[model samples]
Target chain A: MSQRPYNFAAGPAVLPEDVLRQVAAEMLDWHGSGMSVMEMSHRGKEFISIADTAQRDLRELLRVPDNFRTLFMQGGGLGENAFVPLNLSRGGKVDVVLTGSWSRKSAGEARRYADVHVAADAADSGRIPEHWDLRPDAAYVHVCTNETIDGLEFHELPVVPNDVPLVIDCSSHVLSRPIDWSRVGLAFAGAQKNLGPAGLTLVFVRDDLLGHALDICPAAFNYETVAKADSMFNTPPTFAIYVAGLVFQWLKRFEYQGLKGLAAIEQRNIDKAKLLYGAIDASSLYVNRVHPSCRSRMNVPFFLKDERLNDGFLAEAKAAGLLQLKGHKSVGGMRASIYNAMSMEGVQALVAFLKDFEARHG
Target chain B: MSQRPYNFAAGPAVLPEDVLRQVAAEMLDWHGSGMSVMEMSHRGKEFISIADTAQRDLRELLRVPDNFRTLFMQGGGLGENAFVPLNLSRGGKVDVVLTGSWSRKSAGEARRYADVHVAADAADSGRIPEHWDLRPDAAYVHVCTNETIDGLEFHELPVVPNDVPLVIDCSSHVLSRPIDWSRVGLAFAGAQKNLGPAGLTLVFVRDDLLGHALDICPAAFNYETVAKADSMFNTPPTFAIYVAGLVFQWLKRFEYQGLKGLAAIEQRNIDKAKLLYGAIDASSLYVNRVHPSCRSRMNVPFFLKDERLNDGFLAEAKAAGLLQLKGHKSVGGMRASIYNAMSMEGVQALVAFLKDFEARHG
Candidate 1:
């Protein structure tokens, strides 16, 4: 019913409308502080409260252990591609499972800091590879739990032996469902997708993983330094953090199908994914190369059987009030990113549009 | 005249009211794009246009030369302290002029990547050191043109010998006035003080300085890699960049007392600084330790002769519609950061408050 069209752009994708409205309402003044959240010093009590609440809420939402420190960092996932290795690699061997584009990039970046060995690679398969050659002596095993571009996700984390910490780049799917923190030693996500904005990065690092930073690590990006300062080691992306805090609050209050909070959102996400995947499976005109077991619930990349209809498909979708449905240039097909912000109505509308478009051209 | 109090928080400082209003108004829909600026993908046309316009407008405002690649990066000035060294240091000798706390930090950070030699030390003196011991073959000569904490500023850049590049950390004073780019190889600012929001950092690096990143440098922070990708090597802090773009537009349209754009803003800044510094000099109750010639036009750190009155002064100032008058804890006194967003009227109000406070407490 809202005039705003459904936006399906991948990362830096749609935020909840309610969160956007609240951010707008508070732009000029936040909580009677007489300063926009953007204007407040990071060290101030008001902004500190905002940062603290966001951290606490995120911990609760993810069921993150008290042993982990949640860092509100800048420099997106690409920045963390280096930060993770620099902080956790200890210039030692780093094992990476290359499930998709994000994990591949993470591996490539880690090579600069450590001797990166690919534990498993499934870039062509569009699935989380079953076998992993993770080394026990490796400092950390890296994985992209959810690949935004490849539309592949891990249903569960891979087991790493000998307590080699598992580092996951969950940029595209953090907060949509509960994180299995017990399996993750470190998790970093650029906050543009399911979180808040593009400029802020969220890093959750276990206490035991701290203080192993290579001497070359930038102090600002070092887990030990950042943990000591409570992510205020430097001036944080204050506005983005505040906006993310709002998103966290929105998620905490979310309800669906008699379920509450994270469970409710997870259920809704499952439903949305099921509906879209079902539509794709039922359609002779459409094809999804990704394996069903590993297809991302957040991003559904689909192709028309007749590749010639790609442009027409996108054009019609846009006209039908569905936007940014264009697939990434690297992968030529349509990707509908049903992030937590995407409504069921939006998904239903997309499904309806896909069927209508196929009927007209099939 | 506005209900908003005058905010003087140093970096992540106040933004222009008009820009904030426009940002708030466009939060849900941006230029009929059906997506909030925050929701749009960084690579999408709408967001690209926003990024381009911001880069272009910033170039125009600062009169940046074509030879310079302006990077819209993340990580605050603290991050840049390492990034600059990583990108430009070449694991060689880095000469740093220790002006104050910021340059000292810069020097300390640079030491992690290169052999940092203190060319000059004026940390104790609230003035730019007159003499420098320049290394002819040093990688780069570093300086903090405006020290946000110690309140010292270089009115003119120190002359580096043998064409050694002069790198400036002009975080607090960038865009407040023109830069003498002819003498500088690189200039970096965290876009919180005179720009928009806290997360976005602006770097202007000469084309020649692009390719020499140390192998240990994170590709995301590497100037050459970022420049080659047009600062899109990764997903940038899109929302922060968008807001900063709005601030750029605001600055471009700004007019003051027969001056226009940056010149007008510069004139206004000079007037504001002169008014506040004049008040401090004339009052026996107030003191600004920094020398007159080298004092910052943006962040004016002042002290009360009776140090015990500091708490009372800040409390009273906050009650009187003035906020964040407290200085940095490192050099505790009082800092009145009159960034470009600070109006002449706001400065006038602060001056009046200063007079009234002095009248009551002197």
Candidate 2:
């Protein structure tokens, strides 16, 4: 909108402009307190109010059940890969259904704390597998609801064996739609994507999963201690949490015709995904490899039939004011992550760019 | 400052007004890049530039030698309590000097991973101990350069015996002065204090200490992996890093006529500490229990002789716009943390308030 490129980074991605403006206005003095939020102690009244409101608003927004405890954690999604096992695995065998890159990494990290077994792999399906062979008594089953790198996502959470709990790494596609909590025991996401900032991690765990950490688990990272202290066990990331609270407030006010909040965003996301994927599918030069059934609505990783044009395509795209459109290092191509903050105009501009690039290079 | 109270929270504490303003101005789009720093990927060119510049600027500001690797870590001071032992202690006997609350807690956490031995205790000395019984062959000797809650600090780093790495948890006083690297192998601090934000932790470890991590340490947290990858082994707290970079630039431009950079800050801190501590020592009604030799230049904790007036004192202080003056939950009193961002005017105001309160209640 300001004659700059639309960013499509997966995580550590965009935030709403409204939130940014509010943050700017309140930077020097928050509510006439003459102290920035960063200067307040986590235990201080100002920061305490911020933390409490963040948790309460998040709970209301997600419709998180009464039995679930929402925790503000650190150490990104990868850091939690080991922390999740350290707390829940108890050195017991656990099941992981590898949908994409994130799930694979989660299982690998869990191997250090638990006897990990892969229950399913979508590698054969070229998408997130619909089938899951979960162990009945496994300590927990891990899954990545949305894979940022692989552009694959599980449309619906798998029905785990009643004896096992489901822990999800929903970092990329969280808050885009409503989650069915019936099949999940724990849901976690790094806040860089849809929420607000990069440092804060949102962890929603059922209350019963609290106390079973391995002795080796650090006290600061132990779920039981964090939950007991209301996530202030140690100094939580106060500023990041404050920013995330602002994003939640923004979400509460989001509207679209007859829809509002999550419903409104869900409708927009569905429309955006359809438009881009449709454009990609219709083009002879552009191709997306993931199966249609599990194509991610958040991240769309596509490739050109001719790989050599990748450089030129990216260069021209950048010049045309579409930024950060390159794919991940491991997988070479292009990825466009149209998060909640990205508008319909941004996507339309992108679509227009895609058509123009195809016309020139085809 | 704008009729608001002074905030003396040890951490999750105050940041610079200029930096906060810059953050506000660029919150929506960083330098016309059309993306919030939060929206950029860790590996993208835009974010890579940010990461590189921040690291370079910090290294220059601290005069960090090339032999040391600066890692941007998570888990705060407490999380690093676990991470340090897991990465550097490596089941070897680790000698810890109990300076105050932070060192004691670090020792307790290290016990899970290694043979933790307390080499000295200042709980009796009423100060952080100067001499330590550090083991000659210990993996590392740990100290807290500044204890936030106890208002105690080591004015100079202890010179441990040969090959015994000295690890200082400088969480409360990092960048407030020039680090004595000759006697130190590793120095770590949470960024919330004098650095920038709550989620970022800066760890400076000598290169030689990189490879000896415990086998059970999480790969994402392993110092060797992080150091080798330039702290990009995982998705970092991108926004926090950018803000910290801005702070580093601000520090570069800081001047105190004869002093510049950290030297300017150190002098400012010395002056601030003298003002508040002098006021406390001058009044019979107010007392600071810590030994004068090792009083923290950052945190000044003072108690009213009449404990009955504590509540009323806090209430009146709040009315006077002195916020977060409450001490740690473990120690009930008042503490004022004057980081680099807390101006001398703020400290003078607090001193003025203390005098008026003592006079009214004496």
Candidate 3:
């Protein structure tokens, strides 16, 4: 832990240190199987166990309903932006709620497959829209529950007015907190952020939402095809799934402040986010403009009030062992993605750096 | 190498021992970055360098033309079956030369996206089609250069008529031989076979074939969109790409029979095929039924003369550390998939085992 740097890049982000160590130990021989997890056949008993354990543990962690089937998939959130419409839109109209960058991209991509109408927009305020114009005949309503790029999150999910199923892109903040499964018809997240590695995408879809794929949808990406096969329609990202399974195991046994499982992690995330935001609020040289109620508990995109000090702040922070503390180009001051892997100690260290840097520059 | 088994699973198959060792050593941290490659953002400098090095090395190894762009993608061969037609078929007709199980799957998937015409069919016999009635008005001609399950391969590519672009599924034998680029327009290979792992699909497409995708094609799977972004259209399977880059580096530095680069690998593959097949041909107890000219050099599927010895053969092989020797369920006997990472030593040992097993049983 002493030799480690706190990585803060959003999506393709940090994983648990314990998971990495365990993976390293098992790289050459998994459970004495004499083959790396990457070398195992997807259909082989060994890999099937790994994949099954991951699905079971993840289902347990999320408290996903029995009606929902968790499909281990490929293609990131951006891919699902198209996959959502291809599977659910049924070549008809679809409605979207544009909260930030991700929802904007989702709407744009959906238009190619269906007539995507913006049911609600919150681009100007960087908040989840409180109002909505539901299209009763639309196939589904799409919302990016958390914008990885814009540092916005929906702490509370919206209840769709129509019977239209709600598809949520919850890539960044997926496992950080519990999901209200009743409101979600489908939830997709790229594993890199809070799960494990890139290349593996996790899609949780209700069993009823299975078979509405447009003809043009790739069979492997079709929710029904993948679900029926138990996500074995194609060879899954075996290594990523194995690692994600390890993460799930770690989460299940995790203990923090007398809490366990997802609860422990959620509590830690709250503390971590609060500490950083509290420090930011107390500072004169830093700010995060996203509405406080909707500010992401997983990703913290902050801006230097004196923007010229941005580069200096990042470099100084790096020298102090804080790393990848650069903001996305779209919002150019700074961002600190304190994902599940980020510890309370790491947040303390970051807050210390923030205070020290501001005193020097102020 | 002593600790690792001789894995012959048909991919997510065996990888270079050295690559695995290096990966293990760097699993905790990469190049003193204090973050695993899996933990880095795809757009960040470290990952970008890795992505660039891999792309460059692959281009060099394949001698991919300047006009072609190698896109690192997700979704396995099955996904690309749909992706190929969705992008290049342009909602028009496409010609397919069916050789085996894989080509059969491809033609089936393409039907959803285009007017799929079977120009040639070799279903009645396990042989590469010698002739074709190519559709001149078709968007492209599709062929599977290697059939992993059927153990049939095209030693020489079919010459498509009317200058129709040739889309080849080279999944199982991609890096084992040199591809004749002039005869190919788009080549897609799931990385599990000869590359690094599953979940990362490598698609090499000519520039001219880029933007003809129908409106319904998922933007993430769109060739032009991916090419323009240099395979970073979405997160491009960062760890798999990094490991693949290591494989490319290993291939570049590999020396056998005084040959280098793809030539070295080609020679080794040719030797490996000859060694294993020679042993099979000499024995009355074992047989390979494919036409000699079109027998796959990568996947060697052989059968015991007595069907009763199948499980016994597998048990003995496993005891002898010859792992994953069971044949594909589709063609049940025994299969030894000696891809790029399978050594001549491994093949010789397998030959020795075959002889010994037959001597005891015969």
Best by TM-score: 1
lDDT of 3 by residue, B5-111 (tens): 79899988999988988999999899988889999988888999998999999999999999998999999899999999989987889888888889999999999
Candidate 1 per-residue lDDT, tens place, A264-336, comes to: 9999999999999999999999989999999999999999889999988888888989999999899888899
Chain A TM-score vs. truth, each candidate:
0.98, 0.98, 0.98
Across residues A1-362, which tens digit of lDDT does each residue of candidate 3 receive? 45698888887888888999999998889998999898999999999999999999999999999999999999988889988888998889999999889999999999998988999999678677788988899888998888888888999988886678999999989988999998989999999999998999999998888888887788889999998899988999999999999999999998899999999999999999999999999999999899998999988888998888888888898899898999988878789999998888899999998999988997
lDDT of 2 by residue, B235-280 (tens): 7888889989999988888877588888888898999999899999
lDDT of 1 by residue, B268-323 (tens): 99999999999999999999999888999999999999999999999999999999
Residue A114 of model 2 has an lDDT of 90
Docking class of 2: medium
True contacts kept of each: 0.91, 0.81, 0.84
Each prediction's DockQ against the real complex: 0.90, 0.75, 0.83
Mark the regions of model 2 whose C-alpha exceeds 4 Å error after superposition. Answer: A1-4, B1-4
Query: What C-alpha lDDT values do all the predictions have?
Result: 0.91, 0.87, 0.90
True contacts kept of 2: 0.81
Ten residues in a row with the worst lDDT in model 2 chain A?
A1-10
